[model samples]
Target: MSTITLSSAARARATGRHFVPRLSWLWSGLFGCLVILNIAPLIWGILTSFKGQADLFRFPPAFVSFTPTLENYERVFLSGFGGNLGISLVNALAAVVLALVLGLPAAYAFDRFNFPLRRLLFLAVVASIPLSIGAAALLIPNYVYFASLGLTNTPIVLPMLYAAHQLPMAIWVIKGTIEGIPRELDEAATADGCTTFQILRYVILPLVRPALGAAAILVFVGSWNEFVASSVMVDSPSLRTVQPAIYSFIGFFGREWGPLTASATLAILPILIIFALFGRLMVSGLTKGSVKG
Candidate 1:
């Protein structure tokens, strides 16, 4: 094609882009549907908190409240649900920390070394992805084993479970992040008489801090929301986490909506806030991992 014709075609495409009504409508329609789907449940949950359980069960179901009250929120928050949420938070935090401690070094090794069985082991780890090994199936063995180990029905079990469950993906994430760093950097550091640990501390870790932060959040959030393992492993009252509390709420005598709603709201707020703050870094880490080998 001639340069003039190519330029004219480009200009015409640009002009056409300015008035692409069908494209605009398509995007708007899709966006609207997605927004509604995402927001509706959240809005419904919030609205449900304001209404009494009886109000929620009304024949037609009240979409709009004539007499919204704080009862459900009160029940959720003021009750022991707050304590349960606190337990979940602590469990998540402990799990993420444990994962980082184990995963970072493992990731570094996998990224930097030429050890035997590395690829095989990594593939084995990846293979666990599709396998459903939830606590229900493992319950009998877990009880017997943890009973012998004496870690059963304790808060200590939470971190261990969280880390164990998240260890594979966490290691994968950090290892992938580490692999992106130039190998030349390690050699450069070694030439300067730096030890492997020092190189990791000063070089690799600093460069991959964003990925680490994102991993920490992701690991913690997953653990915090983990219901099955916690429910099966910890039957002690104080050890119970938030999701179990929600389950307990359903069985409680008399309808208490206020505190229940408040607890749910509280449970949601921290994660939402953390994501809102670190969303950019998380996106960047994921993109960086995805685009790399």
Candidate 2:
């Protein structure tokens, strides 16, 4: 009886070991398919951007090899797209900077301080996430106000709108990140006579580096991709952003597909580049507090 029991236990261990590899293979293939599915459209856009307009309507779509041309790129540059690209860059960067300046301290306050209506205010921040009010909804009022003030088509309006739009989300995200950090560290700093701002600038900020990076990326991307707001806020050619500028490829007669796709490819390039460079920071921020102190 003992020998039979030992034999069964050994078999069970072996079976479990064998099952893990099969399960891992199954999950690997499933996630591989998912990754490929997500990346396919982006790959197609890049390929289409390279193809000439004649190849666009070809019977069998060329996935591998096709004659590529730079005419679309040339057209994009010659049509004042460079100026729009610069506007987008400036707007995104400025919005992110403004958001961090305003939102980070608010997040820290929410996380560390006890105040009246704290829960209610935090809830409001969270609730803003589901609010679907778009730029069109506020366009008439903003247009009237800005026009009255003679601020229409100014360089500052779009960035300010982007910062306002992204502020609540930034506060909520950073507050959550701050909550994950141990309060004991704050107490320790207090015991050492560190001022509130010093603790924030020295200890809290360094620990929350990942969250700041994530918020910056989110705000930047949101500002960069915003079209309706940019279109409504600034109609001046000099103040237009990349996304609205892409519409120049369309005309009353016909849409220029090649230049449109090329511009789209260019619009998405900065986002991809930003992630490629700093994605690890976001990952680190998420995992930094995972292990117990």
Candidate 3:
């Protein structure tokens, strides 16, 4: 029996040692495939941006053999894409600020307080997340309502709409983070004669910095990439955001692939820079927020 038990344990250990390397290889391969899928288009877009109009339609799609040009970038800038970029930056920043300002307090209220229909309200907020994915469906109604109120084509509308669209998700993210924190901290602050606002400002805010960073990234990205609402809500070129501005490269006749790709390449820079700088904070916040205390 002892000999049999020893042999069985050895076999199990050997099996595990073999299995672990295979499992690791499987996961590594899966991750590599995902990276390719996500990054190939971006690489193609950047390469296309630098290609001349003639090089764009080359046989077999020139990955490296084509002569690159700066004309597309020049055209993009000369066409006032710079202004559109600025407008998008402003709108995205405004939306992030507005969403955070409103979301943080609302999240705290939902997590820390009990009121009439509180559960219902929280459910509604969660439901709204799915509904927001169908923003195209709401375009006509939003346009008509805004047009009636003389808010259409205004500078402020996109920021406000972006904020409203992202607010619920922001609240959800922040609330999840808040839930991970212990109530003992709030109680301790209260015992020290801290008011609700003071407690939140000094204690809760410091701890939930990661979550806030994550929420801001989400809101900023959403607002920056928004196209349908930006297109319908604002008519003036001066009020146009980046996505719609890029869409203008498609005309009734044909598409200008060079400038289109160039604009797209330029448009992604801010987001890339942001992610490069604060990605760690965002990841930390998201991971920490995902669990409850």
Choose the strongest candidate by lDDT.
Answer: 3
Reference-based TM-score of each model: 0.85, 0.86, 0.94
User: What lDDT would each prediction earn against the true structure?
Assistant: 0.78, 0.85, 0.92
Residue lDDT tens for model 3, 191-236:
9999999999999999888899999998898899898899889989
Error of 2 at 267 (Å): 0.9
Cα lDDT over the full model 2? 0.85
- List model 1 lDDT by residue over 1-293, tens digit each: 69999999999998898769878999999999999999898877777777875787787768795478877766566567778878998888988889888888888998789899999998987764322234456667766888899998887987887787788777877877887888899999999999999999999888888788878878877787777878888988788998777767655476445455556766788889989999898777766655553
- In model 2, the runs with Cα more than 4 Å from the true position are 1-18, 130-150, 182-194, 289-293
User: How many Å off is the CA of 134 in candidate 3?
Assistant: 5.1
Positional deviation of residue 59's Cα in model 3 after best superposition, in angstroms: 1.5
Clashes of each: 16, 0, 0
lDDT of 2 by residue, 107-225 (tens): 99998999999999988887775322345666788779878988878988888888888888778667767888889998999999999999999988987878888878878888888
Error of 1 at 270 (Å): 1.9
Error of 3 at 69 (Å): 1.2
Pairs clashing within candidate 2: none
